[model samples]
Target chain A: MSKKSVPVVNIADRLAGFSELWSQKTVAVLNDYEVKLAKLRGEFVWHSHEDTDELFLVLSGRLTIQLRDGDVVLAPGELFVVPRGVEHCPLADEETAILLFEPAGTMNTGDAGGPLTKAAELVS
Target chain B: MSKKSVPVVNIADRLAGFSELWSQKTVAVLNDYEVKLAKLRGEFVWHSHEDTDELFLVLSGRLTIQLRDGDVVLAPGELFVVPRGVEHCPLADEETAILLFEPAGTMNTGDAGGPLTKAAELVS
Candidate 1:
C-alpha cells in the first residue's frame, strides 16, 4: 500500500512563476478548495454576489476594495473580505499581483453590470 | 433614529498603530466576526484544533507553516489555511507581522503539546 501525498507549491513561485493579467490561474486545490492568482490594474466594476463572501490578498502592490459606504485599502501583506450581498469594487493603482479564495462557482464581478464578468472555470 | 454607523479602523493603523507581539488584538468585529493581529517570531509549537480551519496572512518578513508531512512557506502578501485536525507549526525567520482570522474561540497553538498554548480571548 502507498500513502497519498499532497504537493507543496510555492505561491510566489507560481505567481512570479507566470505572466498573465486579470486572468486567474489555479495554484492548488484541497478538498474541493482552491488557491488562485491574478494580476490586476486600473479599476474593476462595482458588483456584489448574493451568496458568498470573497477574500482578496494583495501580493505586490496596493489594492482598494470599495464598498457602497466607503473603501478599504490594502497595502502589501494585507487582506480584506467582502461579505456576501454587499456591493463592492476592486481597484489597483498600478500593476498588482493578488490571490483570491472562494467557492468554485464564484464570479469576479458580482451582480453589477460590467464588461469584466468572468465565467467560472478552472484555469492554470 | 440616527443611522448607526460602523467605524472603520485601519488594521495597519491598529497593528503598527501599536507595538505588541504574540498578543491578538481585536481590530473589527462584525456579525460576531472579528479580525485580529499578532506579531510573531522564532518557531511556534505544533498544534491542531478539533474543529475549524485557521487562516494566516503575513504582513512583513517571512513565515513558514509546517504540517505532519510537508510545509508551506509564505512570503509577504501570501496566505495559507491550516485545516482542522491537522498538526502544524509556524516559524518566522525574523520579526514578522501577521493577521489571523478564525472563530471567536480558536486557540493559538491548537491541541499539540508545547509552552505556547493560548487560551481563547479578545485582546486589543
Candidate 2:
C-alpha cells in the first residue's frame, strides 16, 4: 500500500476533546474493528451484542460491568470482554474514561435500543 | 445462557509474569482477536501482516515504529495502527511494554517470519 502520514492517537488527548457521558468517539481503526473512547459516569442501558464481543478497558476511574449473575469491576489498566449475546450493563461511580474495541458498525446500544443509543463518531 | 466467573485482565499483572524480549503473552481475547503484551528493548525485523491490521499501544516507555515512509513514535498512553501489507519495524530505546491487538492467529513476525516468530500463548 502507498504510504502517507501515520497518525498516532493519544488516549489522553482524545479524551480531552470530548466530555459527553456515554458518548463514544472513534480514535482509530484496526482491520474491521473500531477503537473508541468514551466517558461514562452513570449506569448505561442493559444490552448485548449478538454478532460480536465487546472489549472494555478502563483508562481512568473505575467501571463496573453488571451481569445477571454478578458484577465484574474493573480498575484502571484493567479490561474485560463481554461475550457475544451476553447481556451486560456498564456503570461507573465517577467519570471514567474507557477504550472500547469491537467490529465496525457495532452499535453502542446493541440489542436494547433507546435514548442512550448513539452511533459512535470518529473524533479525528 | 448460564453465566460463570467473569475474568478481568490486568495489563500490568499479565506483563509482570513475562520478561523475555519479543515474547508476547496473550492476556485476553475479543471475538476472534487476541490482546497481547510484549516487552521489547531493541529493534525488530521489518514485517507486515498480509491479512490483518495490527494495533500497537504503548503501556510504558517509548516505542518507535519505523515505516518505509516515516516513523511513528508512541509514548505511554499512545497508540498507532500499522495498516495491513505495510512493511514496518518496531524498536524501543529502553525496555518498553506494549499491548498488541490483532487477529487471534496473527504472528509476531507476520510475512517476515524467522527465529523471532513464535506462537502466542495464553496466560492466566
Candidate 3:
C-alpha cells in the first residue's frame, strides 16, 4: 500500500523553489496526467495542443488566455481550459503562478514551436 | 473558437454554492477528467478505484487519508494522489474543502457502494 514516505505536493512550497519564468516544473503524477507549476510573465507563443485540452489554474497574480475569438481572464483561484485544437496565447501583466494539468508529454508550445518550446522538468 | 461567454471557473465561488458533506459537485471539465469540489466532515467509506488514480487537493481545513499501512495528512494548499486499486478512507476532524480530479463518472464510494455511494452533481 505504500512505496516511499508520504508523498505530499505542496503547491506554494514548490513554487518558491524556482523562479524561471515560463518554465513548468512537474510536481506530481496522477496516472497518465502530470500536475505542473509554472511562473508566467508577459506573453507566450501562440500555440494549440492538437491532442488534448490544457488546463490552467492561476495560483497568484492574473492570467489572460488570449484566443482567436476572445480573451479569458483569470485571477487567483480561477481556472480555464483551452480546448484542444483551439489556438491560444497566455500572457500575464505580472509574474503569475499557475497550476497546469495535462498529459505527461505535453509541450509548452503546441503546434508552433520555437524558443519558448521546451519540456517540463520534474521538480520533486 | 467561441462557445459562449467567458468560461472561467472560480473555485471559491463554486465552493460557497454547496454545503452537502461528502457530496462532490463538478465545476469544470478538461478532456475526459472532471474537476470536482467537495466538503468533507467525519470519516468516509473505505474504497478504491480499480481503474484510475484519484487526486485530492485540500482547499480548506485538514484531511487525513487513511491508507491500509499509513495515513497521509494534508493541509490547505497540499495535495496527494491515492494510487489505483489502493484502499483508502478520507476523514476530516473539522469541515474540509477539497478539490477532486478524476475521470468523469467515477463514483464517490468506488469499489464499495453503500450509503456514501453517489454520483457527482454538476454545478454551473
Candidate 4:
C-alpha cells in the first residue's frame, strides 16, 4: 500500500510500546530513507556514518551530541543532524526518546566496532 | 562547521518564531535532505512530487492529509509520509505546526502550480 494510505505513526505511543534501550525500531519509510525511534540512556559509542547523514530529533528528555570540537544539546523538541563522516557520540543523563532519520540500511554504530552497534529492526 | 558542532534546532521555538502560514523554513540539512518547519492552516492544493517523498510530522493542532483513496488524520506527535507520485492535499481546521522532511529544492506545491507553490526558506 502507498504510504499515504497507511495508518498514522504516533511517536509517543510507539516509543512507550518499545522496551529496548538504544535499539532503533524503524517506524516508517520515506523513499530511500527510514524513520526510526529509540529510547536512550547513558552514552553511545563514538561513531561516524561515513556516507550517510543522521538526524536526531528529541521526542522527550535531553540529549547531548558530543563532537570533537563541541557538543550540541537538544531539548525535548530539538534536533540535530550529524553530517556524513563526522565522528560523534550521543549521550544523555536520563532516559531520552528520539526519532532518527537516515538512509535505509544504515548501521546504527557506523564504522565503530562495539557491542552497542546493532542492525536496525522494523517495528510494524 | 559540521552539524554536530552546530547549534540545536528546536522545533517549537522555531515554529513560534515564524509568522507566515503554510510557508516552510529549513531548520537543518542532512546530506541531500532538509528538515523543515511550518505552520499550516486551511486546505492546500492537490499536488504530487514526482521524484521525492514528503514527510509530515505534526507538532501541535491537527492535520489531515487527503489522498486519492482516503485521508490520514495526524495528531500531535503523529507522522505520515506521502509517497512520490501520489496526489494528495493537506488540510487543517485550525492552526497546526509541523515538521517536514524532504529532499533539498523540493517545491512546496509540486507539479500542480498556483500561488501556494513556494520555495522552501532556510530559517538559520
Which 10 consecutive residues of model 4 chain B have the lowest summed lDDT?
A: B1-10
Tens digit of lDDT per residue, candidate 1, span A1-124?
Answer: 1222433445677777667566777664533445678888888888888877677767788887777877787776566667789987788998889877665556677777567777544543
Cα lDDT tens digits, model 4, B42-105, are 9999999999889999989999999988888999989989889999999999999999999999
Residue runs of model 2 more than 4 Å from their true location after superposition: A1-4, B1-4
Lowest-lDDT window of 10 residues in candidate 3 chain B?
B1-10
Model 3 C-alpha lDDT per residue in residues A21-115, reported as the tens digit of each score:
99989998988999999999999999999999999999999998999887888999999998899999998999999999999999999999999
Q: What residue runs in model 3 are displaced by over 4 Å at the alpha carbon?
A: A1-4, B1-4
Cα deviation in Å at residue B69, candidate 3? 0.9
Task: For each candidate in the order shown, give its overall lDDT on alpha carbons.
Answer: 0.69, 0.92, 0.93, 0.89
Tens-digit lDDT track of model 2 for A14-107: 8989889988899999998999999999899999999999999999999989898888889999999999999999989999999999999999
Candidate 3, B66: how far from true, in Å?
0.5
Ranking by DockQ: 3, 4, 2, 1
How do the residues B1-124 of candidate 2 rate in per-residue lDDT, one tens digit apiece?
3334778899888888889999889988998999999999999999999998899999999999999887888999999999999999998999999999999999999999899999898888
Kindly report the interface RMSD of candidate 2, rounded to 1 decimal: 5.0
Query: Which runs in model 1 stand beyond 4 Å of their true positions?
Result: A1-11, A26-35, A64-66, A69-74, A112-115, A119-124, B1-12, B26-35, B62-66, B69-79, B112-115, B119-124
Model 4 docking grade: medium
**Model 2 chain A, poorest ten-residue lDDT window?**
A1-10
Error of 2 at B66 (Å): 0.6
Is candidate 3 or 4 superior in TM-score?
3
User: By TM-score, how accurate is candidate 3?
Assistant: 0.96
Candidates by TM-score, descending order? 3, 2, 4, 1
Over the full model, what C-alpha lDDT does candidate 1 score relative to the true structure? 0.69
